[model samples]
Target: DQQVKQNSPSLSVQEGRISILNCDYTNSMFDYFLWYKKYPAEGPTFLISISSIKDKNEDGRFTVFLNKSAKHLSLHIVPSQPGDSAVYFCAASALYISSGSARQLTFGSGTQLTVLP
Candidate 1:
């Protein structure tokens, strides 16, 4: 069973507009959520992250919001630029009782965001 899912496979936004990406998870153990942006030939690069303790976290043009009750999260990018057009992956990390440290991330399939000029 897939714990994390990005229902929307793709999204398109006009340049300079706001772009929103959504993700949902079924695991209640998740305590940290992160967003990564990946280019066609490059590895996924960490963009922003939010802890379960907080509902929102922002870094520059990127903002991440988490809704624990709904098991959902979203990433918002304002004034979307061409460079921002890439695959955005939503990932979650949780502390496993069997392990002292947080386990590897559980990632969604990813949503492709295209910024049109």
Candidate 2:
């Protein structure tokens, strides 16, 4: 079975601190990984993504590292801001992730990240 797991339900940090979120997957075929951030009453917005071929990807305050051998990944947000307070969902998809050829997203339960002012 393909399951993407986010072990932590929430994380809180002070402004300007680093916030880390984790995810794990059991499917070996998952070649594309993505992280999305969500605010209340809004659809998740894509934050960053790392193709399986890359070990790490970074964009500004966000960075993601993947350990293929361990089937694990993490998202790091540096110098967290109060506006960053929201739920973050880590998702995974492969070229064949969908059963019937329709694109499907397998999402983690999500972590509520809070950056205190």
Candidate 3:
């Protein structure tokens, strides 16, 4: 079964509005969470991340919130712009062993965001 999941397949928002994306994880071992944005055929670009120890992390217009108890996380983009239109993916990383040398990321399918101009 997929460890990470994004319930929403797509979201549309008007330019200059707020865009909210959500993700859920089933693994309690995941300690790190990241959000990536992809533009068509290009590789996914890192957006924001939050550690399990932190409830919230923000950068400029992007903010990530984590609810450990619920095993859920969310990404908020304020004042969404047309350039922000892309596919957003939620990823979770965890160490496979006590050595912490083998860490892998499990990613959600993706959520396409469309910002109407």
Candidate 4:
């Protein structure tokens, strides 16, 4: 099954606090994991990513940790701002074929993150 699972449908937090979102996968073939942030009616923006070779990746206030042994991953946002309030999606990809061979990612339903100002 291509199920990338985000157990929580939503999260709410006050500003300047930490926001953590979790994800799990059934497919062990996934070699690349990515996190994307989306606003309504817009495409998700690539935030950060971790190769299966690495256990963690970070960018600015965002961090992602992957536990290959556990088939699990999480995203952490420190001091979350109201601007951070949006849908966060966890996606997994395995190598695919094409001229460019763009990786095909399996996406979770997404977790809506709301940060209070």
lDDT (Cα atoms) of all candidates against the true structure: 0.96, 0.93, 0.95, 0.93
Model 1 bad stretches (over 4 Å):
none
State the displacement of the C-alpha of residue 101, model 2, in Å, after optimal TM-score superposition: 6.8
Best by TM-score: 1
Per-residue lDDT for 1-117 in model 4, tens only? 547999899999999999999999999778999999999999999999999999989889999999999999999999799999999999999875552457788999899999999
Per-residue lDDT of candidate 1, residues 1-117 (tens digit): 599999999999999999999999999999999999999999999999999999999999999999999999999999799999999999999999887794789999999999999
If both were scored by lDDT, which would come out higher, candidate 1 or candidate 3?
A: 1
> Best candidate, lDDT-wise?
1
Off-target runs (Cα >4 Å) in candidate 3 are none
Residue 28 shift from truth in candidate 4, angstroms: 0.6
TM-score-based ranking: 1, 3, 4, 2
- Each prediction's total of clashing residue pairs, residues at least 3 apart in sequence or on different chains, is 0, 0, 0, 0
lDDT of 1 at 10: 99
lDDT comparing candidate 4 with the true structure: 0.93
Please give, for residues 1-115, the per-residue lDDT of candidate 3 as tens digits.
7899999999999999999999999999999999999998899999999999999999999999999999999999998999999999999999777756567778999999999
**TM-score, each model?**
0.97, 0.93, 0.96, 0.93
Which pairs clash in model 2? none
Candidate 4 worst ten-residue window by lDDT: 95-104
